[model samples]
Target: MRFALNHIAAPNLSLPDFFTAAGELGVTAVEIRNDLPDVLSAWDPAQVKAEAEEAGVTIVSINALYPFNVWGGDLPARAEAMADYAAACGAKALVMCPLNDGTKVSFDSLVGALAAMKTILDTRGLTGLVEPLGFPISSLRTKAEAIRAIKAAGGEGTYRLMHDTFHHHLAGETEFFPDWTWLVHISGVTDPDVAVDAMLDAHRVLVDDADRLENVAQIRALLDAGYDGPFSFEPFASKVHDAADPKGALKTSMAFVSAQL
Candidate 1:
């Protein structure tokens, strides 16, 4: 299993410390975030590149440019800027997520957005990782829909799906598209009081017996279908971020997931 760490795994860590922590956990690949404080704001791409190189960590992808399917306002500018940073930092890809506000975005619009982003990505030699959000309000909700949009936009090679376990469950999707998947975001939702439809990102935590999102089953299916790319930890719960020993807790969860496989 190729396990990677997202900056959300330890939101409090400095960039250098996050790289060091991922290295210490025996993982060479990591995902950085712009949402996390001082993670991307304080450093230029050159500094990030140098620090990550010194830490022996590879920045797999930037964990995302949001509302990527909605091409309005400053979205185009933001997309280009993120791609520039990713290319400069030696990151292989940029995770692109859709609108989560419940308002519907038409299929044609989705395809158009993808097609437009494809040009930017190709120019920068970066892959656009299209990740469908699964909230009730989310415009895009399934890997199938993302695949359709990608193919429709002629983005088969330029774009790939981010098969997120938590979102996969929330989307109530059963089919798997392993070949089109570029990255897998894994997190377990263990809140018993929350209904499946009511599960929020805040409910996402580490993998364990209490997990309600079926992380193990989803991962098994992906691996069994020959998807050998990295599965990055992406817990969004504040409890995980505030853990006293984030690395130790993460290692235990990683071990549990590994043993299941």
Candidate 2:
């Protein structure tokens, strides 16, 4: 299944420890983050590469370039720097998330941003994994719109969609485009009391039978439809983050998902 671990799953771990944890869990690749471990603030790309290599794990990608839809001013510079770091760190891609603050962004703007970011990603030989946030306030909220923007931006080869199960359910999207999908972020929402619209990142957790997000169904659909890309765990709940034995917890969740699907 090529399961990959997201640093969000264990934000407390150091970058080196995160790599080692992934290796010990039998995962050969992992998605590192600039958000939590704050590698971008402290460590250089070369240092990150060395740590990953030492742990016998590969850095799948940097977690993101935020508000990538609103490209202007420092956005271009940030995109280029991130792409450069990703390239130097031996990471193959970058996750590009759109603005999610309730402000509406035009379709043309989305297209233009993708077009602009394309050059940066291309130059660094990195794929830009454009992830549509399903939040109501998110500027870009569906893979369909993202696919259209990619086509409009002439980004067929340079960009791919990130199919995040949590966001997918929130988006209430019915169609699946496995051909355009390169990475899948998985997290389950199990709270029975909260309405789907009320759900937040804090509700995201490891999948199980009690999961209300239909994670198994969604995953099976994607796999059956021919998505063979990496499935990365990205639980953001404090419960998951504070787990005493994260590796053990993740293994259990992985086994459950494996059995169900």
Clashes of each: 1, 0
TM-score of each: 0.98, 0.98
Residue pairs clashing, model 2: none
State the displacement of the C-alpha of residue 19, model 2, in Å, after optimal TM-score superposition.
Answer: 0.5
- Among residues 3 or more apart in sequence or in different chains, the pairs in candidate 1 whose N, CA or C atoms overlap within 3 Å are 102-137
Q: Stretches of candidate 2 above 4 Å error?
A: none
CA lDDT scores, all candidates in order: 0.91, 0.91
Model 1: per-residue Cα lDDT over 135-195, one tens digit each: 8899999989999889999998899889999999999999999999989999999888999
